[model samples]
Target: MSSLQSVTDDTFDEVVLKSDLPVLVDFWADWCGPCKMLAPVLEQLAAEQEGKLTIVKLNADENQEIARRYDVMGLPTLNLYKNGEVVKQLVGAKPKRLIEKEIAEYL
Candidate 1:
């Protein structure tokens, strides 16, 4: 199983923009409470989706350049990308099913 991967400004292109499967990127920062809440949900999804999807984490604080490029307005913004372009964006903490539903179109 490909565990959830991390994307940095330097590696975003290779990991996310070029991924074969739809990529779910969780943009978070260390000090954000909602980001903390969403982290475990992402972890569970990472394991559940093992081969069906790709999950990546990007630290908003550390990867400000990438975050700016994507226009992340807030912490814990979940962006769904397919073929190098963003298809959907979800903000704040949400249930796993809701997140799964948001990406259903991509699947």
Candidate 2:
């Protein structure tokens, strides 16, 4: 029933870092309001850009090491990884158009 594909500490490398397409990771927590706000936008992006990009969500609370490794100080931090490295970092909730424009650069 979930709209977005959820990633965890276990699958971080396999799903995000090693992905063939550009990966957009939403690092968030269950209790964060902004994280919840970004959910719909991420889902829409995932649905629209299925072949162009891979969208993954990582729970900050549950995946502490992954969040800390990325230095995710805020909730709803969207990180884009390409070829095993982070190429972009977007913090806070943003509109769909803005996010799509940013992601389009890598595609």
In candidate 2, stretches whose alpha carbon ends up further than 4 angstroms from where it belongs are: none
Tens-digit lDDT string for candidate 1 (37-90): 888889898888877888899988999999999999898899999999999999
lDDT of 2 at 98: 91
What tens-digit string does per-residue lDDT give for candidate 2 at 62-84? 99989999999998899999998
lDDT for 14 in candidate 2 is 90
lDDT of 1 at 61: 95
Candidate 2, backbone clash total: 0
Candidate 1, after superposition: displacement of residue 11 in Å?
0.3
TM-score of 2: 0.95
Best by TM-score: 2
Error of 1 at 90 (Å): 0.4
